[model samples]
Target: VVKERNLLEIIQKQFNLTDILINRRLKKRDINQCCQRLLDERQHFLNILTKCRLKIDKNYNLAQNGTISIPWDWSFASNETL
Candidate 1:
């Protein structure tokens, strides 16, 4: 009976250890996925900002050459008070 009890105890300990290891691996995987998702979102936002900057630069250059009128350039107002 003593030998049987010892064997059972050893088996139970190994099972507990395996369970713990599996839990740790699952948590690590979840964290990695979350980090990757955040990185993807940040890259998408940066791409949008880059496109906006390029468009603004193009508009500014066109306005400087008088090829297009900027909406904020209100210098052509008459002296009529409203």
Candidate 2:
């Protein structure tokens, strides 16, 4: 195709240029690149996650047995024991 021919022509023209590194790296390592990519992705993820609120099953019984007092042992669970 014309695109392929143009790309090869450009490569031949810039073959002696030392200002750039076009060599593909190995699959194993890109520590700095990986860290920077992860940092960028994490920032975007956190920006979206902070504005989201998780929904739970509201129909489920959270306290069906009875009104249990605080700091008391019961069938459900006692956080005081923790």
Candidate 3:
């Protein structure tokens, strides 16, 4: 009976150790995934900002060269008596 109890105890210890190792691996994997997702989001935001900056620069250049025209509306100023 004593030998049987010792064997059972050793098996239980090994089982507990394996469980802890698995949990540690899973936690590390979760952390890596979270970091990757954050990096992807940051990259996407930077891309959008770059596109907006390019568009604004193009419009600014066109306006500076007198390429864009704005039509004056008489009705807009009709509200105010000249």
Candidate 4:
């Protein structure tokens, strides 16, 4: 009877250990996925920002070279009325 009880206890302990290990592995996988998603979003945002910067630079160059005319007929001192 004593030997049977010991065997049962050992089996229970092994099952509990396996459950804990599986839970830890799942949690780790979730964390890794979250991190990768955040990284992808950050990279996408940076790409958009770079495109915006390039567009602004192009517009600035065009304006400086007089290729693009900005409407500036109104003067602060000679404004008819707002």
Candidate 5:
């Protein structure tokens, strides 16, 4: 429980810094702000990757059946343009 609480606290701090960097309207942004922005972007990208991994793992077995197909009718332009 202590480990989980510490992890949550760190995440909350990161999020708070991110929010500060995002919502601040200061005329002179500092290095700390830029660093925070980078951290936030990296964290956001990691979050996206994690979600994708979970989805792929959850659907892996179902996808193996090979019954899924996507329509491609909109992939090509009309012949009139040629």
Candidate 6:
């Protein structure tokens, strides 16, 4: 699932995820778009977040990034760390 500013084009292309994220594609979104990622290692058991590098704004609370492993749900679930 992509966000407002998702850099999915480069990520999907580099990772060869066209079939996964974009089943069939030609005209792609700009690489500048950024997105957040969630790790569902164990369904309701666990989760983690990782935001696109390009989305790291100056006001972002990066200090809390990876500072703790919180519940993998809701708002915190969207806080990217990868």
In candidate 4, what are the lDDT values of residues 1-82, reduced to their tens digit? 3543343233324323221111132334443443333234443334322222111111123335233211112122334322
Q: Which parts of model 5 are misplaced by more than 4 Å?
A: 17-42, 45-82
* 36 Cα displacement, candidate 1 (Å): 0.2
lDDT of each: 0.28, 0.27, 0.28, 0.28, 0.30, 0.29
Off by over 4 Å in 1: 1-26, 43-82
RMSD (Å) of each candidate, 1 decimal: 28.0, 25.5, 28.6, 28.2, 17.7, 13.8
lDDT of 5 at 33: 38
Shift in Å, residue 63, candidate 2 = 78
Model 3 Cα lDDT, one tens digit per residue, 1-74: 35433432333243232211111323344434433332344433343222221111111232353332111111
Which is the better candidate, 3 or 6, if ranked by lDDT?
6
Error of 6 at 78 (Å): 17
Candidate 5 worst ten-residue window by lDDT: 51-60
Clashing pairs in 5: none
lDDT of 6 by residue, 1-82 (tens): 3542255443433433322232122223221222223222323322222231212222234234332222212243546543
User: What TM-score number comes out for model 5?
Assistant: 0.24
lDDT of 1 at 16: 30
Candidate 3 steric clashes? 0
Candidate 1: clashing residue pairs, number: 0
Local accuracy of candidate 2 as per-residue lDDT tens digits, 46-69: 432232221111121223433211
**Top of the candidates by TM-score:** 5
Global local distance difference test of model 5: 0.30
